[model samples]
Target: MKAMSPELASWLRGRTDDSVTVKRLHGDVSGRLFWRVFTGNGTHVLMDSGKIPVWPWIDIHELLRANGFRVPAIREIDTRRGWVLQEDLGSRRLLDVDDGQYMKLLDEASDIIVAMQRRLDGRTCADSIAGRRSFTPAFFMAELENTLETLFFRLLGVPMNELLELQREMRTLCESIDPSSVFVHRDFHSSNLMVVDGRLVMVDWQDARFGPPAYDIVSLVRDSYRDPGHVWEDRARKFTLAKGNMNMFQIARTACQRSLKATGTFSFHYRKTGDTRYLGYIPRTLRYLADYARICPQLDGLVRKTYRTLDKYHGEIDLRDFRSANIPEVRSR
Candidate 1:
């Protein structure tokens, strides 16, 4: 832990009384840091993005709040400062609940997804920055390039030169998912959903953009952080019924790509922080990427190619035994 910079402290002083105190909180993979601020009046969370631009957060917060989403209430914001002070929404995340409550909260999150699609589905979507951006095939490949770099080439022994066919297949995987179908909460998952005031409040929505209708669903039910058990298929099916056009195949395809992208993210975080916690998540997502083969038989070639390359390079990562595979506590640079 490091001391707050003089610049950030000074910025906060003006917004608080002398009784205010600050403590660091667990952060996400992004370099952004969060602080729990306690004042004589109440408690709040202060987000410090280090040097990254914070307007996207501010803008997206306003957009979601205006559209009836239960995001944290913004108390103060300074994009140049790269910090935002907002309602704390407490520490209990959607994952930190009992099984029954978990399903209830998850249902609320799913409803939010449907509402998001209905309300944000219009030409007016382009007016906001979220709607203006989209998940294109190239964008999807760019995300997988991280996976190829980290999980395949760097971690596994796959040669960089050996990636041409896999990359082509990955591009095909990207092409199967529809782009700009709906407004997506780019990283919607249990960790990002805070349980506040008895409702599921969506956080970390700065990356909201136009993507496949199944993207957010995939991020939620197929979350890498927690296994939602047997209810997974039922949730996806219900979401499909609510959306009308989205189907199981679409969900399965997006899950394959999203899970792979998440694998790369977990690997990237482990490599950057020397954290072993991220390693446990990899096998699950790899299993998820493999399990979709039944629903997406069209991707059979891609799946076989991926497994062949992995088995050729890394023998320990057998998808069949992924659940029981033991990841060593190796420190990464």
Candidate 2:
């Protein structure tokens, strides 16, 4: 365990009389640092966000809790300093569960999402959150552009003309989705879900915003961390349709959009932080995107073109060798 920073130590001293111990926790791709703090009373996690304010997290936490979702409790907060003391939800993530348990948990997760959506449906209080954040066509296209810049252009050295063509297609596809108002946890994958006392708890709520109802459910089933299999995907689809009254096309389209952005995010992380672990997930994410493309007629040409381009540069662009390359760093938020 590394020594606690003076600022954190001082903060702990002010709050507790017992001896305090702090240990650094494994960090996420967001680059935010977390420390597990122990005291005579109990254990807590402190998030150090550097320049980012903690108010959005605090606000979202309150919002989710009020809507009957399981989110971590905020024990203390220092808004100006970008630090938050929150309850320890344990280290067992949904990704750590077994096959049978995984399917069961996902079913429960689907139920929770349906209940939450129903609770917020047509409610005036939802208007406040919807006003602040949303998944507009512009936002969706920007994410696709991010992937094009990082993965296609920078990493693979794709031709500018081709990149532009794909960008246009992506923009069109993004614009096709109906801009329905619903709560969406932008990154509701297995890694962001913690299993505490047999209940699935959502974390990283800062990115929650208004988007299509199928967005979060697609993210949950077609996750990058674990392959939930075709059987599970079918089960999930049936459950979602029954619970939320959504159709297959709506879910598949959102999945395609989300998977493309996720692939770009993985490439961006590897390029920026010199971390190759993220590259391993790109192939699976691309497969998910391709699956959706096969089902959606509008995405056929773009997917075929992109796959052909990838095959053309197959031997040349090795993800393993990328770490040794002299690529310029481009940081993304």
Candidate 3:
């Protein structure tokens, strides 16, 4: 592990007593660094975001907190330094729980998402957030292209001609969705959610944008970390339908789109960083894509071809051993 920068050390010293200790915490794929800062009084997480800006996270945190959502409380921020001190929400991810508790947590998460949408629906987002890209036909189509380039071509060895036809079908399917202007948590999966004080707390708010309400719901229920099984999936659908007023088709369509993006994202992460943990998620994400494709007849044949390609090379790869040789093991404090 490398030492903290002089400016960051100075900043931390100014924020706490001289006896305070700062230790690095395990970070996600976003490349941001997190530190567990222990002072004489208590503990807090210091986010050193490197070149990434902090305004979006700060703005979204305020918006969600004002609406009674359980986002981490902001203790301090230095937008210029790309650092923030936030309330420590602990380490219990929704993915770390048992099946029974997982379902209950999903129900709670569904309620929170619905509440957020109800409060912010049709309301213009902050200028910074509003400026971010909306989920349009082009964006959906690009996600399909990303899947074809990274997952099919690079990983599964599918031919260009097949990928092009599949891309066309996916684009057509995406074009059918009516555009929505509701507030959306672009990455609302299990890993970004923490269970704190027996409540669900959402993190990683910087990527939020305006889009369809069903997108976030689909993200939660069809998360790549763990399979919620058919029973929980149905329960989640019912909860979202009653709270978010989204029909099954809308949810399924969003799930298909999101799952396609997930496959590309997982593959890209593996290829770029050599992180095999992400590769383990590809199969589950594909299963989600396959399941949702059944409900979307427009892309059925393309999906069938995708499965055939995956089956062709099913047993040849050892995805679990692809961890990057250059990356160091960093333990969470």
Candidate 4:
């Protein structure tokens, strides 16, 4: 493995009394970097990123902490280089635990999410780095269109002409949705959460947005690493009830729309990176979409529209497996 730059190495040493040894930790989807520093006294985490530096992180840490949620403690922050030293929440996440513990941990996570939402201030999801300033109806439709065309059509092999037509239809369908927006963790999936020392902690929270609350719920339950069981769903519902005054039907509908958007996102990732992991997630996500559609006949037309597009582009992918079936091959720019 490559070594850290001399300046960074010296900086780490100075931070830890010249007793720190740095080992780089792998990053996730984003181009950030993390390092585990072993000091003579104790361990400390060092994170460096050129994008999404410390301000947003500090904002979230402060928000969750003020709301009495269980999250990592921020030790220090440097905004320019995106560096932070936070209290390590340990390695056992929801997925690493046994079935009995998993449910409880997930419940805790849901509770924390609800608490954040309940105590959220007006600017909580707008001015923060994770916040979205543009989620108006037009913006939401454009986002949906980007997912449909770049993620679904262009990446998955739907014909260009058909993609244009589908874009219009999807935009029309999306225009009908006027969801009650709230602070949303755009990527609330499992890996970003950890169960540390019998407490559930949420991490990697630099992508919060002012969008539908159900989007966060969908991000968690419909996560690729683990499926939310019936018990978990029931708990999530209870948590949702405690957080917002929205009815069950509204929550379910928001989850459905979010799931549909996610399917396109996962497909886009797979098509761009040639990684099948995201593709494996589609079935479960589709289950969310299909099940929710069954409850809301209003979405039936949109479902049919998606299927029609899929039918037209069924044979465009190159892989000879489920991952490739009806998949689009995203062209490089």
TM-score of each: 0.93, 0.90, 0.89, 0.83
140 in model 3: Cα distance from truth in Å? 1.5
How are the candidates ranked when ordered by TM-score, highest leading?
A: 1, 2, 3, 4
Summarize candidate 2's per-residue lDDT along 143-243 as a digit string, tens digits.
99999888888877788898888888788879977578677777888999999998899998787777888888888889888879786458556766676
Model 4 Cα lDDT, one tens digit per residue, 1-333 = 345667667667766777567678766666667877787877777777655556776786676666676677766666676677767666676778887887767767776666666666456544455454435568666667667765556656677776677666566556655466676666777888877668777887766657766666666776656876566457656756776565555555666566667767776776676776776666556555555566567666666666555545543342223233333332344
Model 3 Cα lDDT, one tens digit per residue, 144-256: 78887887777656777877777777787788665775778888888899988777889997888878778888888888787787854585568656764556667777788
Predicted candidate 1 versus true structure: per-residue lDDT over 155-240, tens digit per residue: 66577677878888888899878664788889889999988778888898888898888999889999887779769889999999
TM-score between model 1 and native = 0.93
Q: How many residue pairs clash in each candidate?
A: 0, 0, 0, 6
Prediction 4 TM-score vs. true: 0.83
List candidate 2 stretches off by more than 4 Å. Answer: 1-4, 122-131, 314-316, 319-333
Name the candidate that leads on lDDT: 1
Candidate 1 displacement at residue 2 in angstroms: 2.6
Question: lDDT score of model 3?
Answer: 0.75
Better structure of 1 and 4 per TM-score: 1
Q: lDDT score of model 1?
A: 0.81
Best by TM-score: 1
